[model samples]
Target: MTSAPPLAPSFDAARALRQARETFDIEAAAVAGLKNRLTDAFSRSVQLMLEVRGRVVVMGMGKSGHIGRKIAATLASTGTPAMFVHPGEASHGDLGMIQVNDVVVAISNSGESGEITVLLPVLKRQGVPLIAITGGLQSTLARHATEVLDGGVDKEACPLNLAPTASTTAQLALGDALAVALLDARGFKAEDFARSHPGGALGRKLLTHVSDVMRSGEDVPRVAPDTAFGDMMREMSAKGGITAVVDAHQQVLGVFTDGDLRRLIENGIDLRTKCAKDVMHLRPRSIRPDALAVDAAELMEEHRITCVLVVESDGSLVGMVHIGDLMRAKVI
Candidate 1:
């Protein structure tokens, strides 16, 4: 005799929306509850991570393993040396990856994942400091942990209360909290973050400097203060649509752009006698080559202009950056 087949799950739009809202509420409460549970253990955990000479080894099982991977990534990107080592794999030869100087962050909602529990004695023998993120205060993981972070949730968002929902959210929140505290303690800055994420958007904005994208050398349009209007126009048209007026020492005196020529023509001003110095706009907006490319974009946006000259501290013209250059670099 065969058992009856399970029925297909029925969908209810109104019930689905209600469940979504409840899930959010439960998850939010789970995170909020962590604030009151903060103890000196959090600081100790951060100090352990900060002082570790080797990488942070994060371990977990099942759903907790997924969260562990994310936590490891967050820690690594935030200036902490960290990587995830699956508990199941650790029971294999992968346990060799852990070093005595490394710190271990173990995650388990029940605090009794067998794979993680089995490795406790070995970790203890190796003298690796363990920080446990778990809900069971008196479970095996908590017992062996040098620091135990309470990730307890009153109830799961799942209707059956069997799935890891609110519990996992609480674990993730705790992981973020750890990373944030560790980063703060280490004095991690945006520049450090950009260095770790050189391929990301923030990296592009922070690591890319004006020198990286600015037109330099012969590509930069420039003219002497006494250069003839026709000669300056020729240089500007050949280089870019703008020309910088400089002294004998290459110290920027002013700038003349295509817009200036258009305005001069519109006003019917005599241009035949107008040398670079005669028609140039004095003290045009400029940026240092070491400045972030985003700053150059901001300067262009603020001045309602499409080009910005790059200069040294002493105001010597080094290069020029156009909005087009910034666009090509994706700095804008």
Candidate 2:
């Protein structure tokens, strides 16, 4: 008989799952440890970011460097001006980019990397303030920095305990925590973000207003309540808008638009039986004259129509603004 096939090696899936849970717990502990440790150093970092007259330069090496870049970007977007600098690049003459007025955030787990350590003497000589994020409080980097943020973890999540995975994740979380703390301390608002990001959608959403972008005065298509359907049709045509505002005593009575006309015709209703009160949409959705134009645009979109009523403090029809008006002015 042929020799039996060799049996496969025994593997327990439950054991593998237990190992994964152990690694997860290690990382969780690393993060949970941070909540109780925030002290004066955190406050000082916030104060430094607030008082910084120039950009914050973030420096780190290898994996820490990657985390540094993300931290810098988060800081910049949240009100603090910041940028990333590689430790290796700084050693090769990029150190000149730092100024005495600027703050330097140097990250290192060992706190003894040659590339980062080499810049210390020069930074000290130039009077640049240094902040360190490190695992070991007694490491050279911590000793040299004006502020030391503890990024310590009990152990790594790697199976062999040799990789930087869990340590780097912890450090990244700590950096983000610092940035968000600074952001709140500065009372940074959406308006401030809009100023920094004029091209971004958030800026557009928060900043663009109707008054700044709406068409006004005689250009608005309008007619008296008693005006004939023929005259209202002419007004709509002349204004090239979907609707015309009807007024009496300078107060808006109703709105006449193409949709209204279609509904009347489709039902075979008496065209003459319908006057402004009978044919026009009564008490149509209206917007404050002083409200943001974007609000008006939103109203139009919400109703799946292209027209809006612009009302005054006394509910009078001061004018009418259309989607075209808002779009042409780029308010929409």
Residues 170-286 of candidate 1: C-alpha lDDT, one tens digit per residue? 999999999999899889999999999888889999999999999999999999999999999999989889999999898999999999999999999999987999999998999
Top model number, TM-score: 1
Residue 73 displacement in candidate 1 (angstroms): 0.8
Q: Tell me the TM-score of each prediction against the true structure.
A: 0.93, 0.77
lDDT of each: 0.95, 0.80
Candidate 2 lands at a TM-score of 0.77
Off by over 4 Å in 1: 1-10
lDDT (0-100) at residue 134 of candidate 2? 86
Sequence-dependent TM-score of model 1:
0.93
The digit string of per-residue lDDT tens for model 2 on 95-210 reads 87898899999989888888999899889898888989888789889888989988887789988888887778888888888887887888889889887887777776677765
Q: What lDDT is reached at residue 89 by model 1?
A: 93
lDDT (0-100) at residue 235 of candidate 2?
79
